[model samples]
Target: MRSFFRGVFVIFFLMTASNWASASIGCGDFLRDIASPPDTIEFVGCESEPTKQGAPLTALYRVKGKDALAAELYLDKKMGVTERMKFVCCVWEVRGETFYKDKKTGLGYHIRMGSEETIHNKREEWSKIGYFYITVVHLREPL
Candidate 1:
């Protein structure tokens, strides 16, 4: 019985580890790294309160890279702030690559993509690199 239990424990551990290894950020993981205060970086998404009745809404994400360098991505939407919610953008670093993905859209858009340099100094190198904004639209009913 003891040997059987040990085998079960080992299998459980391997399954958990494998699950973690398979997770990938569709857009990238840059935003994830920035959401935590303790993190060396930070990302925030903001949208203006709807003003005009029919005016298109816009969502903006501000990614503050290390050393205070910052970049912004904007998305236009048709939902109100109450019906739709935006979470802190996430950034992830993997294999020397920096990736940015919208928390809401998951892998739907690639707001920013770069090598190690872009992640370290986004403010200065964003234009030179391929920094772009990703917008995601949801069709959930209003709360």
Candidate 2:
């Protein structure tokens, strides 16, 4: 009986391990090393957890210093019309730089792409590196 239970446990873990790999990680201060706004970026870790199932993910990156720089990115529906969102309403507008789909859920999302510059004091040496994000959203019927 003990051996049977262990086998079950192993099977369960193997089935769910892929979900863990795709799970969102707790992220923190991104681009905290930069010294100026709209300048180059040192990519830092940052991720947002969904408050509920299928909730959209949001991420932000910024550095605190003189001439500080900041940028916001989030995954959600596009500003254009969607059949799933015909009845939902919100004042906020979201637009994605590109489109993406999840392999596990097969859900499509609009993603915002941000960029950071290469860490260089010299203006000419600076170059931008891109970042991408995506999360799920399902609008509910108005109350």
Candidate 3:
């Protein structure tokens, strides 16, 4: 009986471990290292809010930085991770745009290389990197 119980325990452990390993981590983990330069990202937090039909809407990170940078990440239900990233490039309406695509490495990035816009104009960009939905917004700092 002891040996049989030990066998069952081992099987349970393996099953649980495998499932945990296969599970995709939340978006916050993907954004942990990301930073919008001049302001360092110190914390990456995640939460799920109640939505319609009892379904939870996950806001991977709703940042409220203290003397730092704050931002939000939003997902488009109609777009896959890669498709959403492609859309980001088209929406970037900077005066001078530099876009880079790397099919071999599956990495894409762009830089808004143009004249600065007026402070009142909202500057926002969205993209996906890996499993992360990234949003970069330039806004007037709140007093």
Candidate 4:
């Protein structure tokens, strides 16, 4: 009787623990990718528009609390081209990572990520260190 009860208890604990663990990882949340700044939090979707100066196409994220654009992206006139992105909020320590690749088209999203320390730390804030553009350029050098 004791052994059976103990096994049942273990199984129940395992089930509950798994649900809690999954919720904490932020895997259910998605990051917003380019035509926007690197500092923008990853979300399920991001919108785009031509900027006021009218050069690079900008990717923008609407931050709920701030009610403003969190990041901006500069895109080429043509599709699937290289980009320059500026981060506006709560992102520091950026690095480029190749998240996807295509065998046929040879196009992929080379993305920037914040360091673990910075990513987890600055959740609800804005960017601007020394009042300069926190920009990342995604371009491959000449082959």
Model 1: residues with Cα > 4 Å off, grouped in runs: 1-30, 33-38, 48-106, 113-143
Model 2 Cα lDDT, one tens digit per residue, 1-143: 22222222232222222222233323333222111214432343434434533332333433222212222311122222221101112111123233334454433333232223223333222123223111222111111
Ranked by TM-score from best down, the candidates are 2, 4, 3, 1
True-structure Cα RMSD, model 3: 19.6
Q: How many clashing pairs does model 1 include?
A: 9
What is the overall TM-score of model 1 with all chains considered together?
0.20
Residue pairs with backbone atoms closer than 3 Å in model 4 (clashes): 31-42, 31-43, 32-42, 32-43, 35-59, 37-86, 88-127, 89-126, 89-127
How many clashes show up per model? Answer: 9, 2, 0, 9
Output the better candidate (1/2) by TM-score. 2
Residue 116 lDDT (model 1): 23
How accurate locally, in lDDT, is each candidate?
0.26, 0.26, 0.23, 0.26
Q: Candidate 3 lDDT, tens digit per residue, 19-87? A: 121222232332333222222322334343233221121222222222111222211111112221122
Estimate TM-scores for all models.
Answer: 0.20, 0.23, 0.21, 0.22
Cα RMSD (Å) between model 2 and the true structure?
17.8
Model 1 residue 56 distance off true place after TM-score fit, in angstroms = 10
Tens digit per residue, CA lDDT, model 4, 55-81: 111121222222212332222321232
Residue 69 displacement in candidate 3 (angstroms):
12
- Report the backbone clash tally of model 3: 0
Residue 18 lDDT in model 1?
Answer: 19
- Which parts of model 3 are misplaced by more than 4 Å? 1-22, 26-29, 33-39, 42-44, 49-119, 122-143
Worst 10 residues of 3 by lDDT: 134-143
Assess candidate 4 and give its lDDT.
0.26
User: Which is better, 2 or 4, measured by lDDT?
Assistant: 2
